[model samples]
Target chain A: MMRGESETYGSGMNEDKAQRLEAFEAEALGYADQLFRVALRLCRERGRAEDLVQETYLQAWRSFHRFELGTNLRAWLYRILFNVFNSGRRQEKLNLVPVEETISETIAWDPQTPQNIEDEDVLAALERVPRDYQIPVVLADVEDLSYREIADVLDVPIGTVMSRLHRGRKLLRSELTRYAQSAGYQT
Target chain B: MQVIDCRNYRELLDSYLSEELSVETNHAMLRHTEMCQGCRGEMAARRRLRAVLKRACSTDRLGAEAEQRLRDCLRRETAGGVAAIGWGRRLRRLFEVRGLFHLAAAVAVAAVITAGIGAWLYGAFDGPIARPDLALSPALFEQAAGDHEHCGLKFAVLSGPFEMPDSAVNYDPSYAGLEKVVAPAAAGLELRTVHLCGHKGRQFAHLVYAGEGSLISLLVTERDGKALDMDQIPTDDGIAAGMQTARRENLSIGAFQTTRHVVAVVSDLEAEKNRLMAERLATPLTEHLRRFEQQTAMLSRISFIGRR
Candidate 1:
């Protein structure tokens, strides 16, 4: 019943519109896996991550007209994902005061890189890092986003992204080193 | 090419791995790593760690059922033509004369229908009508009452074994010692539980109390966008004033706003009694929150000056 409008339009017009939507879907849906991976890290729950990804795609579809044809669609989708997540947690934004001071102090003591660590241990260490720092780390290290892109996704200055990444990596390294020591791995 | 030391190499390694450095810096890094075996080994370890993390995280794919659901939802949206007209064009068309008049008429009709339907739904034709002057969102009252009923009274509307405010320091630092602040005013009531809970996407530091065979919830949440309709009420030296009252169903909600938070007292008590309790509970809590606000303001101002 909702598709009644399609019958009203001529075949040529409907075909062209259908082609455009298909093109949009073809381009946008390809990144669902990547988006879901990042969403999982951000939400830390399967159901919430799936919902976040769905909401991101829906929002992206609604605003697809504004998106430039040749720009980075992946970054755009990520921006929308962060926007949805942040808006949902707007109340929590009040507590997001910069913890750079404490984090910077703690990161001064860099641990030696640990060896023979399991993949699970690495993930556990990454999870142990505080969320503010963990985001930049995942964006930069895991997702392979540049500092500029990470900054753009997070809506923070490039310098802030760099510092957060630096600190987050250090925290991860320390966690891994601690894990390695407990598991009797070489450091 | 410029010469580099271990310190520079160590500092730039992360950027180097992320491919953020310029060609010149990359060359310098390569030259240093070629010469310094220690830095090279560190680089290898860091790279290996990055790979392991990526591989571990990549294991979590969108489940097949979820993917199928997403496809179905998208198909429905496409069929419904929801995204055919862009929101910008729709918004622009809203200001057209005919569109504006039609919109106004529709809103008027909708308001009347909503008021009548709402009265019928609540079965409270004589219940407290929201004063137009106090432009608070009606949802705020419903959310507070719903939290009191579902969370405080265990109505099964929200999942439970909720966390205490002490454990919620990661969410909001002010929640760390909130019970101590309200203990003086809540002396008579038996404190049932103090926990951080959320209802309808809004987070609350909910402190439930029991007295006179009734359960009361003292909730504190960030105003976010749910601010009072009136001009800013002056807090005379950290003292809370202007307790706004509203009633929903059988519950009375008396609320006040600080610079950053909305504190409400919701219970089945009479409106006047709820208002009195709100004043008592919110005074100390308001003073406490105002201090946090002032500290935050001063910290930001100091940081602003430092940045300049």
Candidate 2:
């Protein structure tokens, strides 16, 4: 009804609106599977993830006035989902990292650091990474988001995102290597 | 091509492999990767890690239930005959007790105000009135009484047979009074309504105040005589004849005449209280009428010039 006055009150409004909405849905619906997947990972629960995804789509639709057509819809939706997750009052957990590496600037990563590994179990490894690190790494690798986009989505400094990505990959690799070994894979 | 050291290139290794760095930065990292095997190895490992994670994460899809719920949400938003906030529907939470209660209260208040204003405008005329010489005429009193009763019933029942046009709804409380003059100026009082009413080619400002379970109606109308005559009530400065108070069927009515108009208060309170309220209202309402007449004259002159 807010879209057009003629369509809202005129005789042919219903059929016209149905066609317009169908066109919009045709474009927005394909991203649902990906949106649910990311929200699921962010929330770590089924119920909350559904809510986050639903709100994200609804918000995207509401603010479609500002969205320029033919841009990266997936990234736009992800940004909205990330905002919902961060703004929602989730329980804070102190994910203890070694004091030396807690601050990104203070991290001392080796260029060719080695981990003892036979194979990789990336799914289990992804779950173990702290939320701060996991979000940037998953956005970067899984979603193919660039460093700046990851920073924008996570609402952190570019330098902090870079630090998280480096550390997150290292931690994920170590955990995956452990999972692989237990599963008797040699790599 | 610019040369780059291994340490800096290693820092930019991920961005370089992903081609996300700026062209200049990407060029520098490329030169380093081409020359240094160690940096190249770091880049390779990152690429492999990215590939594996992407594959594993891509496999994750929602079960049937979540998909259905999402579809239902979409259906409700897109085509359910509900007005969308923008292109999408509002995300109103289920079970908003406080919100619903506030909405109902707002509707009630709106109904009361509309009825009060409507009654003051049209419900107060008795046949065709004649120009009377008295400050407070019996005909005017009869009309005010009818208005009070009609508006009171409408307030109690929240529905009426009257219909108002869009132009008739132009009453804003802040602008209801003369400049810097408004209702309920006294303490422990609340304004019920203030409206412009008309009868027999004369207009009256009908201001109603309610507080302490008592209702007061102050009517200001044009005065045709210089002196107010009401049982020869004594006057302070010859304007507020506060000594004159009369009873009309368990209701106390009092009147005062200023330089240009007569203002009266009709209430259930004591005669002295009614006189005090009349005294408070009479002076300012007279001043407002004087200013309003001057502005109307000025506007007419301006429009006459434009037409010429």
Candidate 3:
């Protein structure tokens, strides 16, 4: 009788575990493609980007128990993605050297947005932006992440995120303007 | 609220566009943009730029093969019971089970604890557990050999005068002049073709050489985790310490890892000859890759500092 009872209890526990895993798969796996798109820009290689996404999902799954339901799961997953990406290069986190904030501050002129800009030109221009600023811009503009969400994802102050996004957009505009002038397109 | 000026409008424009401004500020922004055509136009232009960026980036999606691999990896993680559900909860669940299941659970938990202790004792957690003898998947060997057979030999048969395209630099700037780096090492080999090609869903900078009626393929691919059995442990010079050799059918492959890439030499030569040729090629290639890695790191660091 005790043996039968134990077997039933064990099966119940197994079923619960399976259900939890199934729930995780249903909720979390849907974001893989979106995460992969961002990962591609971050790693700059398809294979590494895929691996990064895989690692991100694995990390997310491991901590799935801590994740709150009905909250912004998308942002949480993105936060984990950035965490995985950043953790891999922990040694590169060197002492902060203060530098003049010249790039964003000096944009005295608002260049008119160019017309007929190829997608390739825009992507190449975005790639040229410094990564520190590029990430925020991509998060806000491309991924549609809010300033607060980007701040959480990047582990920086919200003010820093806003400033970086501002600077990154200005830089992107100038790059687009340069491309337009070179291509002889009327802006 | 204070009356908003042109400077304040410009400063608030991005926030307003992002819908991050408070209601009062948003109303002020609206009033200002309504009166000022310039701010409105700038707002429209910025919105257009954001839409363009989103459209461009959306074109890239996860490849089918990669998605399948991710699913497989997650399945394995689940099957292995590595979901990291806390031990306390697990123990509680174990106790919730009655007689025979309790014994079984205790035994399983004891075994896991023992294995963990043994692994810790062996210093397996010190870094990536390096299984030097079999450091890469057999599929990778087959993929390298397949690229050698299909890309190297078949292209050699076609015998088109192939020059590395300028667009290869878009994939990796190092690919533009890669032949120059490998040329000295390949003394007697006739350089047949060099191009960036994809095989079995992985991209490689493929350089084909012909010597003594045998075709050799030097492939450099990004080191995704599954490409090797262990996480790469780079030495002080930024290249993994030693060569890893594998054989697939008639082909012999010898590979090593730089910080970001895997460099392999695939040929139908005897194991010893292939190993020797791989060693010869590995030196210059590893050195070149190390320098490139350093330069990239330095450039990113400089950019980081500049941005901050």
Ranking by lDDT: 1, 3, 2
Residue pairs clashing, model 3: B135-B229
Candidate 1 — what's its lDDT?
0.70
TM-score of candidate 2 on Cα atoms, chains taken together: 0.47
lDDT of 2: 0.54
* lDDT tens per residue, model 2, A1-187: 3445435433423555556555556777788777877777877887767766776775566455477879877778887777655544334321323234654453354424233332235677788987767877777878778887766666667777777777776677666666766666543
Residue pairs in steric clash, candidate 1? none
In order, the TM-score of chain B in each prediction is: 0.51, 0.38, 0.54
Name the candidate that leads on lDDT: 1
Better of 2 and 3 by lDDT: 3
**Model 1 TM-score, 2 decimals:** 0.54
Estimate, for each residue in B136-232, the C-alpha lDDT of model 2 and write its tens digit. Answer: 3445455444545533322221111122211112221112443226433544654544444433333345556665467766665544321222222
lDDT of 3 at B275: 85
Docking class of 2: incorrect
Higher-TM-score candidate of 2 and 3: 3
